[model samples]
Target: MSQPRAGHAPVRPRAPVIRRAAGSRAVALGVCASEPSHEAGAAAVARRLALPLLTSGTDPRHCTRLDALLCLDGDDLSLRQTGRRAPGPVRVDFGAAAMRHRRAGGHNELLGRAVGVGKKTPLVVLDATAGLGRDACVLADLGCRVTLCEREPVIAELLQAGLTAAARRGDPWLDALLSRMRFYPGDARSPRVHSDPAADVIYLDPMFEPRDKYAAVKKDMALLQRLLENSPVQSDAGQLLDWALQQPVARVVVKRPIRALSLGERTPSHSIAGRAVRYDVHVLRSLN
Candidate 1:
């Protein structure tokens, strides 16, 4: 989740790009790679992404040939398209309005404790499932070094693009913060976060399949829901939980909505609450 980013528009006005090849339904992270009937412009985007052609709608006839669905947000827009929307509580531009929204029966307080802005532990965060790189930025703003990990390369590219653009724009702080963000595609299984990382915390915002069916969960959250639904069942939920648990960090923070079950079966050592969401804070006394 990206926090407090402003002064620039999103990466593009249209749907983000994704790989062209068709991987497993769950493994593909909810993206469908098929040739678009409108191959002209779609091919261009595909060329730029260097991924196999993906069809969001699943039916080439419904979507244009050049209409490539790159699965940047996890869901196949072609399958169930919800166009880009205004940033809600999860948006980086979240200001008084969003804070107010949270204060007015939303999840804000919990966010505060988990992302303690003034903490002194050389705050390093490893966002295991960086859906859109928002949370990592928030932690960085709070004086933490964050390493964002996303199993899908398509989303990673967009994140990298945003960070690079932020860097070039001469936002020195954000640029320096970008230096702190290293994107890795795939999970802990890919040998990305294998070696000991310089992080005091390993954060997990794994996909939350909402059962409440509340559409008011904020656009960013909804977008993430759409994006990650296609993650392979083999997605490393178990391994990630275990590895993070074993990390030499002082804590492992998992972001979840209020009353929601833990990411995996294992419970957190402790928790912090926001209005709409709650952070399961697992304190690692071994490190402490």
Candidate 2:
């Protein structure tokens, strides 16, 4: 006798597929043959991050396998895309001309005012989401002992490399500014960050959703977006805000999009508005 047909059995529901971001996903640590001196540094980074290290005469530009390459290009360690039409490399360069210009132009008047830099004694700032360390560098330039907390390993590596490069330059002004800044490579919500005695002002700059329509996002920002496309923290800015509020700090400052709703839907004590962004100040106690 023929067996009963299996098609009569009940069918189980299929699991939804998890989709990854578009474009190449493999990234490697590459050291150019033009500069043999950077091999050791690149190798160390590769080992540390457990990423593949590409050396020899292999040209990163023509290497079709890698989507991106963390390269030790001469004096700078930069993240460069491998595609022919990719944007330029991105690096955390605190000594860049733009940063110097900003420093000279009153060191970001609004950020300084929002952080209570000149308004009060030199404060200790805990930058909870120190992406590129740009704002932390600014705060340090304004005489605040700024602790930079970055959970992402790649970004922390970039910040460390930038600091190392800047330190080797022996520039007095740059050294003085960097002296007040410290990089903490971990989550800001951990007990390690909360136990920091120097944390007088907790600053949160959680990544906001891109708001511009016609204007192309900045190169560095676009790279960051791609890097953190699948990050859990990307959708948990409210949680970060809530944790910052519970810290034993005199104030918590949140950098937000100009028209976006308040973080966690909780109103700030007051807000300092700028052209493109605003500082939502949550005053817990007197800075006195």
Candidate 3:
């Protein structure tokens, strides 16, 4: 809940223009009226996103011009692709996945090792590119205090909603993990983030052009890529890498696909290579 310092202003990026499909109709955001409890929340979300609330019996299937649909389904809020063949609804579930990863012993995981999680003292990690917050959740579950910075408004909203739901579950262990996590609403490249002295390590996961032609990308990731493609929010790998290297943090970790080149043509001090991805560790200073 700590706010960024006074002099550190947030970078105001251009707002995303919601695109419409071929037809003339506009995309709508709505709740399933059968679940009346979700009406208020849905309405608020629609208002914030500048989307219209679809009326009862509004058949999304027939809305060929609609590009996307944000719906409150029971206890979950989801964004579904309507006009084209989108992978699936984009939502975050931290409870089950976090617990599973923790139970599976993540100390040996490449990310965990790269982030120096098994050290004597708990590390504070700033996940600068916290897409979906999956990695942040895993790091939190492994006893790291994680500050997740998400620049995209829609993705940030979904992450906040997911964390809220996870906290309400009343699971002691989950609550403990959630307590160690924080959300920041600004670009990772913003001065607000770099000026903060709390984090011991900064993590970057810059999105690169998809190289998988023969293999199917995960549904959630595919959906995320599609949404990002249409939004004004973009990741500048070179700039992010440059800023991170100059930070006072003990180390900077960059996640890259195994075969992809290093960000900005700069190599890490060392790297942990996996079958599909690699964690490039840049040691600014020793944590010890």
CA lDDT, every prediction? 0.53, 0.71, 0.69
What's the best-to-worst order under TM-score? 2, 3, 1
How do the residues 1-288 of candidate 2 rate in per-residue lDDT, one tens digit apiece?
011111222222222112234443323334332365666666666555555667634565787765667787655778777778778888888889977777765437778777788656669899989987888888888899888888877777778778877887889988898878777777887777665556889898877754434224676467666666544344577888888888788899998878778888899999998777889999998886
Off by over 4 Å in 1: 1-112, 115-121, 194-197, 210-224, 233-238, 286-288
**Model 3, poorest ten-residue lDDT window?**
4-13
TM-scores of the candidates are 0.63, 0.84, 0.81
Instruction: Supply the TM-score for candidate 3.
Output: 0.81
Work out how many backbone clashes candidate 2 has: 0
lDDT over C-alpha atoms for residue 141 of model 1: 52
Top candidate by lDDT: 2
Name the lDDT value of residue 244 in candidate 2.
Answer: 83
Using TM-score as the measure, which candidate wins? 2
Whose lDDT is higher: candidate 1's or candidate 2's? 2
Worst 10 residues of 2 by lDDT: 1-10
